[model samples]
Target: MASKMTSGDLDEQFLTCPLCMLHFRDPRVLPCLHTFCRECLQEWATKQQPLECPTCRTQVSLPDQGVDGLKTNFYVNNLLDFVAVKKGAGPGVPCQVCEGGQDGDKSWCVDCAAWMCDLCTTVHRKLPGTKEHEVVPAEVLKAEKDVSKFQRKRHCHKHKNQELVFYCESCNALVCTACTVVDHRPGNDHNPVEVSGIADDKKDKLRQLLSHVDPRLKEMQDALKEFDKETMKLDSSRIESVNQATSYFQHLADLLQKREREILSQIDATYRGIGRTLESQKEAVESGFSRLASARTFCRQAVDYENEMHIVEIGEQAQRTVEGLLLERVNLKPEQDKVQFSERVSVTDFKNDVERLGVVSSTVNVDVSKCRVVTKTPVVGLECTSVLETADEEGQAVAVSREAVSACLTGPKGNTAVPTQLRAKDEGRVWEILYTPEVTGRHRLEVMVKDRDVTGSPFDVVVRSRESAVITIGSEGNEEGQLKKPLDVAIDGDGNVVVLEQVNRRVQVFDAGRGNVLKCFPIDNDGLFGTGTDSNGNLFVTSFGESYGIRKYSQEGELLATFNPEYLRHPLGVAVLQDGRMVAADKQQKSCLLLQPDGSLIREIGKGQLQDPWFIAVDQSRGLMFVTDNRAHKVVVFDLEGNLKFSFGKRGPNRGELNGPTGVTLDPAGNVIVANKADGRVQVFGPDGTYLRTVTTTRGAPHGLALTPDGYVAVACYTGHCVELYRYK
Candidate 1:
């Protein structure tokens, strides 16, 4: 029956399906919290394997049964039922059960989902099937405003007559009593329990999720408002710049008429660029805010109105949605370039140099494409130089003050290093930039002048940590000299390649230049993964499985001590900092632990940021640590205190993409060398996490990698079962 919505009731837009643009029919909610008709979603899902929500276009991982497996929007259903009863389907609604004439007052059958006349209601009561059904007088139901009190008991779609009495915990589905005995019988795959028994716990979990999402919603709202303010500021700045140019040009109107037009045009062009950037940023903020708000509302609705089974079905998707939102870094400040008109002329100067009277300059005037790096490759701890020749709008080099030019070097974990000198030459047109990097890795050199970025402000710079290896080492074998499943590699202070074998359960030391095996020691355990060395020639190894711990050893293969921190589970990679502290990456815990030299836990790093932390490398000189998260497909960098500086990489086969990164090591210059197990490639990045280049693609999957003192990268290949050295300078 059709129902009329009043002004006081829920908005029609909320009840209307996005796909059909009609009142929702069996409304179903997506993980992204957008609602649509079940049939509409089912039809849409048929077009794609991983369904994208028609409203938001979010990728949705549909349940095994597809759209039909989606949980019902009980809140919307209840509202629809309430609105139907309140409006009486537009006066004298005929009894649906009897299909009678519109003559007598009707009573609403909550269970049968129909309207009945008084005579029909009496007959319905007399019928054995409808004896316990709730039949309320239409007038009385219309007066009721509490929608929760009108919640209908859900029934299994397979057995329409039987109510859903059991919730299958394993499959997270609701089933009728008869269906539970057949499909959801007590087994490993299907654990069915009473709906009432699991309700409280599910509700509590959903409530907790709501509480977590509420703060993020507020954050998104605040960020949206901030972007709005920035938009206003951008407009104000644009107007101010135009006015400044107008006022100055008016005084010299007759003498600088043509110049005035050119300057104002430059200002307009810059404003348009900045405006577009600001608008894009604002749109992103608004989108994030809207997504979070909708998801938050859905979480609250599910907890308050949905049945236990429905809650369980949506729990995983909801958790993923919330977790993904939390990981998104909100841009609190506007990043658009500032628009301003600078007067490069005085009255006397303008008269003398009319053609060059007033040059319009901005951060965008540097012409990044025209700028060149004088140094081909920057080596860590060494002086590097890049030349920037400031240009006019036409790309002609023009003179500008040193203060107008700025160069910033950014590294992994968001660490920023500044150039030592920005010497202006060639009549202040050509800038000679000089800087020394302490750590090696992928870094960006952002050159800006007059507050705006050059065309390509942030230039990719890969700082080499070490030169390529001059030799190779190790071969696959079960013998003492042969390597088997070489999972991790480290360079001792004496420049020896220390390899950890996973299957052989041995730490084999080999000479740097040759493949000769120097010494070997049994690990006496399985799941050995990572290895590292300190300046004192001591070695540290991490292992999991049966014997999981961080083991310390001397250069002579003597076990010094073993540390099994109570909280450290599945330690994968280990590194010893200059200060005698230890850092270990725990794959199972999804974090890196900082410990004292004596094996006491100091603190955890990248706690919630890493998904599968496998290996770690450190630049103690700069107080930075780099971690390779295998599952996350990124290298997360953190400061000494565990504060995330930044992270880079993603899942792809492209140049910079990291697919299941396994081993990470830093060169003397802080260049980060990483081995990707999935792709079998070893990539080099600057300290800032910028992918420099792929050193080499191995025939087998690459694991633990290390940079030797003599300028060689020793990579332990698990599948190849060998340590291959590559020259990396």
Candidate 2:
């Protein structure tokens, strides 16, 4: 039978099926408050050992003998009935009020037995004086109360008209009002609602609230799962590094790349010549296209007039070109495409060959291309030649230097002794005796830096040496006015300095010439991103993932795409390959990720035996990838197809061994420089894993290191406030 059902004319939208993801009709509301469709449940019950509700995931214990009885529910039948009537398949009644609400508060009159609203009180008494038609509110009716039947089955409420029938004390039911007046009311002062099922109703609601709270609490637990790891809890190791500020770019290196220089310079010269030509052409076009001519003369010249008789008379054809004194030739070449500006600002860099070192953990290995760091003590001679003594009006220009060295003896408190192993330039012998350092630890050897023009600036390079009695040298820092150690460094295509900072989540880009920061872009605030620049000047960053994935950003630092697929976990290193693809090394996930240009997931590479690929480097030309595993202390090699090819390095503090090596770089000469962050040194090795010399950094906590194309070493130290640029002397 169909039934008309409505709830005040407002239609309600329902969630259809979780499987099909549609709005539900014919809802089969279960006791668990989850709903499904009749056909859906029957299909699920077809060949089942046991039946269960698909929505609430509740197990159903049906009687084994009768399968049909437990297959469908009355609630679903009611929904079907309502829809059938809505389509005019059955009765059409205006159900202005909903059948639900106020716990079924409205009740049907015994005379009519039809539903009635609160305003239908007058109609409810249609047949008045008929023993005050037994009445009750709708909520009491939900308890399945029938007032007439209940009254007939009990005593009157006002008069206690049970004829003194006594209520049974054991049974918790109303017998007679006469019994309540006599014995029931006085004796039943002890928790009466307990017997009336009110206590049971309250208990049911409390149980419902408890069940609801549990799932919400579980959802919160899922969100906090990533932070419950070993690494994030510990203090970062390289918080104590030193620094010196310098900027070394790789332009000179590009100037000598075989025929590449000549080709590019030829193109540049052609462009310069084009610029000169465009300037002249633009002037001519502007003068001719201007409105200096008369408008009527210009309009007359825009068309041509010829007569057929004149053409025939002048041989076979005669054509005359129209000319007005004010009108000239008009040549519009579409404005040369409006001198188009690059929509993209090549935040990458003005130059093309240089690239930023990707972001990495402080526990990865770094390589120095062909650049080598060596220690040598230059010969010294102190013969004060007074070329021309001039009296100083403002001040006299003199060489001033201060150094702390236990290797060099304190010469007579004030005057420093010039070592005996020196000869003058006039002696015709320049490379004479070597004045090596005396003591054992890292040393600082100083010489007075002087410029012939008296306008040159001064800086220092810390000399580091062991007991081999070899002279040591390092690029300088903290020289009263210099910045301390830098936290991180990234280089763009033009060899511009970009730093992924620890204290803040900003990617800092600096000019190569001045070493001054030009722009800063912010990334994830937790500071786990590996940053790299693309050829189009876009910034690609890899940071730790909460739900396990990588995030990409534009050069202006806008979020482009994010994916949490089966890629690397806790990614730390990010690099853009030449093919516009992106790669990242995840430290905790122990793998690397590959991303398409649109930030789509395009296969991940290097997983499984990798413990912690803290930093990843890509040599796109060779289709080879290098990932540094911090705990294993080796570099895992992989091809573009995610195949494991080879591995390098082991866990140890030996010369070739890595001790929490943090940064890795491939110099133009194809050598690898490992910035052993813990060892305070950069270990250089050949491309074939040959043991090259080590350039010891005197700076503490030297975490990041890179080889500039110009053969300078750029190091990021944690404790120092600035990045140090080094030139190998």
After superposition, which runs of candidate 1 have C-alpha atoms over 4 Å from their true positions?
1-14, 40-66, 88-91, 105-107, 117-144, 209-236, 239-263, 306-309, 335-337, 341-729
In the range 446-560, model 1's lDDT, one tens digit per residue, is 8776665666667777776433333556677899778888888988887888999999988988987667888998888778888888879888888888789988888887899
Report the lDDT tens digits of candidate 2 across residue range 190-209.
Answer: 11222223323323333333
Cα deviation of 248, candidate 1, in Å: 8.3
C-alpha lDDT of all candidate models, in order: 0.77, 0.43
* Residue 285 CA displacement from its true place in model 1, Å: 2.8
The local lDDT score (0 to 100) that residue 415 gets in candidate 1 is 65
Clashes per prediction? 27, 41
How well does each candidate superpose onto the true structure, as a TM-score?
0.47, 0.35
Error of 1 at 423 (Å): 13
